[model samples]
Target: MVGRTNIETGKVTRETALAAFSYRLKTAVAPLVPCAAAMERLHRGARHRILSKGDHILRAGTVADEVFFVHQGLLRYYFNDPNDGGQERTGQFFDEGIVVTDAESFLARVPAKQNFEALETSSIIVLPRTVLNAGYDADHAIDRFGRLMLEEALVGSQRRASRLLTLQPEDRYRLFVETRPEIARRVPQYLIASYLGLTPESLSRIRRRIAGQVG
Candidate 1:
């Protein structure tokens, strides 16, 4: 059992983390594999990992060997812009109940272009590629799940790319807030600005304008 100390209470919360992981796994996999035994077999080798804020689970130039399911806290997927003095440009934020990974890197066995970093103390379930591959080969439902996950990832990537290329900063921010209000609320303003391809000041102005309109 993997656990971390609760910062406020200074007590290990292993059971809480475990319970969250189990619940999230079931919620994610149950629709694809309704059978209890098959779900168990598919996730047989999944393990828990705890990451502190600023920890990099997957970094640029490294192949992603595992898929992570966020059970608690937040994660950021970003890449450094070489032309902009290696400025970190946020790609996406993964919060509770999200599955995260550099799918291309994991599938192609190539170095990742972006990094996966914990934005806060996070508990995640790690599914190793080897175990997942075995499950995929052995179970038809597991294979379908994998295929659907990859397709979703691809579609999400394309959508993000299109938004960045076509949308105005304010529109981008609005769409982001509309689609992922929880992430917008939880993430730092500057990081959110980066994700939307806007300056912090610009994002602040946009937020103020939006608030004024709402009021």
Candidate 2:
């Protein structure tokens, strides 16, 4: 969502209105921003945890408590489809410099809408939802920042949904790699394949073909 550009023009759109608004709030808010006082206050009670591979950060139907900022490793955001006999697919991969949270749960205070799990051993810095809400209520700047984050998240979801319906499988994989180069390397092939909506065997063949061309 952050680095996306218009496919037709390739022009950088990083300074779009939503991004500017989010940036202003993220840097200006007292308790949620990066000012010295805010940093000190936030660091005082924040918790950091190391999650092993396959650890569930949040499971569907469960309540989510904290928003996680990824410090290291990869995480797969996915869910099981009961109608399809409980098949799982990687909806997205969260990597370093990315914030991974169950947005539906965090925003609505309801059960998680999907499952989040670490694909590899990872470390994350977490701040409780209560802390975020307190900061949001106390600072209009923080509330604006939250809204921007939600807007970006929704845009990303919509794009992914559209791509899944319209793009070819290989094109989807290529676009995913172009967008998330770090994740393309950090996550396993099978997981990446799932995220691209391809079978493992087809993914392997595609990898070999691509490698051959590079060679």
Candidate 3:
């Protein structure tokens, strides 16, 4: 739906712009939404970025002083285990229409304990944390926008943690497939397994079971 490249600058294409606009309309504005002024200002402030698969958006232990909204492609939030020879522990996957950032680091102005890597070629809108702060202070609409984004992000993080703790592995896999079919459809099996807090072998077994159950 949102696949377009800029003609001259080639940074933020027209289609992605519309994508961001649509995202704001649906997520920020549509529900309890107000005027479009705040969302427009935020969109204008965004710096568009394109990344290929495997690009590192944020390295571990670095300060994530920016927020990014994905317009196309996918990103994975993860940690590389030094003790386990840098084995990746996938924390989360973010796709289009979603904002991705190191929330704890952004809020606390501290180093991130995790890394953000591109799972596929991605188009994203980057907004500096300082800019967002200034906007929040200056405009009530922007403040409301920020609150909504943060609230959703927090709720998602909580839900992910709670489900992982409470659900069985297969149930987690099922929930993932049910809730985030887009991610499940595109991401590699091992990474999906990692995100589901299961080993690849376990996931394979679960898949087999699911197939049998469905069949």
Candidate 2 residue lDDT tens string, 60-165: 9987888776655578799886877888878887765566688878877899878989887766667688767765665565566667667767898899999999
- Colliding pairs, model 1: none
Clashes of 1: 0
Cα lDDT of model 1 by residue, 1-215, tens digit: 23444633434244555556555544556665435555565456777777889998899999999998787779999999999999989988988767779988998999999899999888777888987887777766677667767777889899989988999888998999899988888889999989998889999999999999999
Off by over 4 Å in 3: 1-15, 18-27, 30-44, 81-86
Give the range where candidate 1 is weakest over 10 consecutive residues by summed lDDT.
1-10
On residues 126-176, what C-alpha lDDT tens digit does candidate 3 reach at each position? 888877776677666667777878889889989988998899998999888
RMSD of each: 3.4, 9.3, 3.3
What are the models' TM-scores? 0.85, 0.77, 0.85
lDDT, candidates in the order shown? 0.80, 0.70, 0.79
Angstrom error of the Cα, residue 182, model 1: value is: 1.0
User: Which of the two candidates, 1 or 2, achieves a greater lDDT against the reference?
Assistant: 1
Segments of candidate 2 deviating more than 4 angstroms: 1-39, 212-215
